[model samples]
Target: MANVIDTLFSASISRHVICVFLFISLVYTQNTVVFQPPFVTATGPTVTAFLLGNTSDVSLSLRTVSPSNTTGSIGSPSCTDEATRWVLTKEQIGKTAVRIKLRLNQSLHFCGENETSTNCCTKLLCVLEALQVTACVGNTPKASLLVQATINARLFPASAGNDNKTVIPNQVYQPLGPCPCDLTVRVCDIRCCCDKDCASEDLKLFASHCLPGPFGGQVSPDPDYQCSVQTSKNSPDWFPFLCVTSPPENNPYLGLFYHGSTITPKSGPSFQRQIVSAPLPVNMYVQGSPIITLNNQYFSIPQRVLGRCVNGAPVAFLENFQVECVTLLRSCPTGSPLQTLPADLSLKVMSGQGGNVVVHVTDKVVTDLNSFISKNNALSSAAQKLLCENVTLALDYKFFWQGNGITAVTLTRTIGTLISNVSVSLTTRYSAVFLNGNITAEPNSGNPGYQVGKPVIAGTMDNESESIQRAFISIWNPVGDGLCSTAEKKVVLFGKNSTSGCLLPVGQQTPPQCNLLRETVTNLQASLITSTYVAKRGNPDLLNLTDWMNISFVTLNSSTAMEDTASTCSGIPSHQHILVWSLVTGLVEGVPQREIRDLQIRYTLSTWAQDCGGGNSLCEDIQLFPITSSVTFIDIPVITEPPKARFQINFTEYDCNRNDVCWPELAFPITRYYTGEPYSQSLAKGMILVFCFITASILGTPWRQIRQVWHSIAL
Candidate 1:
């Protein structure tokens, strides 16, 4: 009886402690206060409550209900009836709070007042544990009120499967909890020896590659600390076991439970700053900075999205872009001009400084569908009937900036018909030029000396008129495999001398029809300049010795003209070579002036050798070869025999300023060395004179002493 009393006393003390803890939690927890409304009353199987907040619309959703604890004896009636355990209804009270009414069915029973309940309240057998009420207001932050009730005891212990907290997996697949390799059920996973479904045979085959146990299963003793030993090991024979290939798990992030500073992620910037209000701090613009615009709205560039025009794409600063989009036109205008589409609207240039916005330039798109049709003569006259066509081909933009911001902008629109219904083979180009806060001029090929990649200054000079005119030379450019008929002409760039060729057709006509081809070739060669004189600065200045010079042609061979066979196609030159000689003249303001000294063209006339297939009968199918031309530039100067050098010695008398003849203290020779000799050779000769004086002193003194000794011996 004394032991029973001690047990009862312990039970009473435990109940009292739990009641005190519950009261403390009710007063301290801020999140729980949102759920405990001012009034809650229960009648029979129904519950009614009034929630807080009158401005928002409140709605309730069931989250969780506590499980019932019933120890059933053998053969006892089973717990049944689903309809009796139903719950329902919620409504908003007029401008005061929300009213929630719940009706419980008869299948759920209330606990006895004196009984110790499990998984629910002592007074109630089945009770709500968690409920989420969402309150929403128009254009306001949504509020979520979460209500969770605490009980003295629960039927089931909390496990990973029952836990409400979410876990985000790492990028690399690693075993979490107990079964990382148990990814499939009722089937043996490949190379997964740890899978329970796998038989002994399957594990034997997987032994070569599969790891012994769960990957990354070892836990660090200290939650706040980590080391390399915790990293997951990789199987040598197998690739990423269950995830995309990743490096070793050296990342410091130790799951959400690790102790560290909580970091909330933020989104990237959606819009750029306006130019008018932006301060002038830096000269160059960064990648995401706003483009300078006249209006307060954001500046947008026309872009192509999936082959169609997407007009309002935000333009990034300091980015070069090009886009081509297909635009649909309803019809070619007959009486009235077609209205401009939003994509065809112009962009205005805004000054990148000051408080007030200023417009500096504006551009317009020029659409001439008629001109486009006329240019392509192959187009049918029914172009007007096919009015619903894709016409806009490309849009080009060039932005000019001066340190602080963009100062000018130019737009060029190229309108043309599309080859297909959906797309066009065109692009919009963008370029930015920094002027350093000044107007920029066109760049020159070279200031004085020629730049390496810059085009050579080449033109034709008239001998009779003494004038020069600029001209460009072109060569035959074969489209595919050097076919003659399909070849196009392309201009040659200076310094980039290259050879190209195309086959020429030969026809057997009465007066040798190839003569027309020969005449055309001669006319092109006639305009080439053989010799010319050029000035350094402007026109030739005769008085300036280094101002002007004459450049002429020189040939390697004695022959000046190509050899030709009369009345035959063989006379046509098969190959022609243009050789240019140039040299650096003088440097003007740190720029080298590379001047052309000589130029010559050598021609190799073809010879006809026929192998007759019809036994010496007039060879009908003669194999004619292609004509080729090549240009070569040599950076070598002309060579000439230098004049002989002469030497003269000059002697000046000391004090000669007052007297007619006074002996000088020093005199030197006036001499000139050969062009290739080193200037240090004169100093070497002076050193030789000093060596002679030292040698004479050593020999002459010894000879005088020997002679004196000889005289003494004779005496």
Candidate 2:
């Protein structure tokens, strides 16, 4: 019995030693060995430009600098260099590309800390930070020069189970995903207490709350490890025999334990270069991928989903589209009809330092709808007060992007009068503008000529005639009363003809007041015709006839006579018209290039006192009828004299043969006459030919006589 007990104890000790050995081996394999791949430079030269002073292409490169005399492999002691980086003197990020410049022969440095240190630090790797340039003088090419380089070291720590390589989500606390319940822009979702977008005051009024699982779906319940009441069948095999009892907090598996979870799954190559087709070669967006900024954050734009505005909606890459969303404004229940503009929390913008910045700015408390209109207008003070409204009717956004990400955005808002207790729908428009270089001016309608549906570039010429002062051809915008009291300038789009007018209310029409009103309307008409030249391209110095078109202004007197000379006056401004003439220069890639020319602004004056009764004479409370402004684009080509024939034997329709017809319409064999021929002569020739053919056939003439008759008929 003593020998058996000793043998069993020895067997248990052996098993314990074997299990300990396996656990140590697994830890050593995963934590100790750090495998790192070799680094490579980008395929092409970084930036190349043709210097005006030099004939050859001057190029630059970006490269990294390694430690001096380093010989050992990565993660080895001999190759260890913790501080490694390349710094640029200046960096400019444009719409679709980034331009970074470094001084010639700049010093490289190693200053950054290495978080992936295995022994104090991980081994230093190669770096790509350099702008290499080759100078060319006239026809002579110079040797390549390395301008600068950056030193690169390991960035991640050597760890077990591939924990350093796994993708850890940023918003780990929001287990249900970001804003699953927050549907409206700033309004609180119903019964969604977890929604952070809800106001503190608003959330207090909820009748009930929703119950959520632990960690809001982030953690799953593991009944086996949890210390809870359990049935005998579901418990350990000991089943009350040798069972141990402990508090919930003191449970062994209760704190940070994983049973069946795969903390680190098998991973593939970390970096991949995917090739995708795009309109431009520099575009970096892939199909179906979310649009991202340079810092790898998702690029979000304002989107309308299910009739409500969702500000942080992620935009897909390579999507050139426009979406209109209804933006709901909070209405104050008791106070002023206007509510405070809600803060825009969805847009994400970055500055030069690569940090998020707020793009929306609050300038004025109230936006005047009639601010663009002349302050000295004839409309009464009461009528003018009605023009200013605190409502934002339209939002126009222009996004400028490069191949990598969006670089800049422009926002323009149109304000209109907001009425109390009335439902108003806000319209938001989006547009994507392509930028080649650092451009500040508005994008041209077309490159070399004008394109249909684009805003025409109409502006006055500068003193130097080198550039144009841009002025828009706009119509008056209307409001709730359908009056022309809009402050926004609605630009006249090319190929679109529009005529809009509004009633001008008159309070008192004395002689001096009537003259002032006439001047006010006349001045408005003159201001509308502000520009003298229209251009096809952004730059008018191109000197091409199709590039610049002249604009002429003319005034016409109304032909209508006054009803009574004493009571009715005839000085009222009636109509204003802008006649735009455009001709199709040519077709480029199936798109017509319209060369706009001969822009004319015509103003006509008519009688205004006719609206008031002739007996009244005072015209005290009369309102002038609609004062109109119309824009018409004539696309028909102008008629010009036909070109003179260079050689004799003119290609007139009169000298045409049956085989070689001069005119297309008379080319068919059944046609009796050619174009431009005398009708009597053609009829007489046809009769003679028919008579001769019939007589020849009746007399049984030979085929040769018939052929001779055909020739005589031609004569």
What CA RMSD would candidate 1 show? 37.3
lDDT of 1 by residue, 1-715 (tens): 3233223222321122212222333433432213333212232344544444443443444333222335221121122212324364666545444555555433333344675544233443344343333343432323443333222322443443733232534434332234334333234444445656554543454355553322312332332223322335633333334334333453333222212223454544547533344333332344346564545455666654344455656565544556544333334423211223333345453444332222232333333343333122233454433433333434455554432345455555444433322211233333232222122322224433445565443444554323453333456666555666666655554467888877655544334545576664544433333325433222122333343344444323335454433434445555667766667755432344565556556666554344346554665553445767777878875456675454312333344555465444123212332223454775576578889998898789788899899999999
Report RMSD (Å) for each prediction in the order shown.
Answer: 37.3, 28.5
Candidate 2, 1-715: lDDT as tens digits: 3233223222321122212222333434443211010111222222212112121232323333323335421121222112323333322222211223332222223234744433231334343443333233333333232322234443444443642232324222222133333322223343445656444443453424432332121233434544355576678776566544554434332223222222454445547533433322223333235654444565565665444466556666434455665434333122211222435423555422222323343222223433322223233344322222555434444544322334455555454454323222334444433331122435556533466677867776665334566767876554445544543346888888898776665554444355656776776666566777777442233333444667787777645653435334566666888888887754432345566657888888776554444555645575645668889999876567676675534545454563364554454333644545766776677788889989977777587789899999999
Could you tell me every candidate's TM-score relative to the true structure? 0.30, 0.41
Off by over 4 Å in 2: 1-299, 302-312, 316-319, 323-341, 345-348, 352-357, 361-396, 401-407, 412-440, 482-488, 536-546, 558-567, 617-622, 638-715
Give the lDDT of residue 412 in candidate 1.
Answer: 50
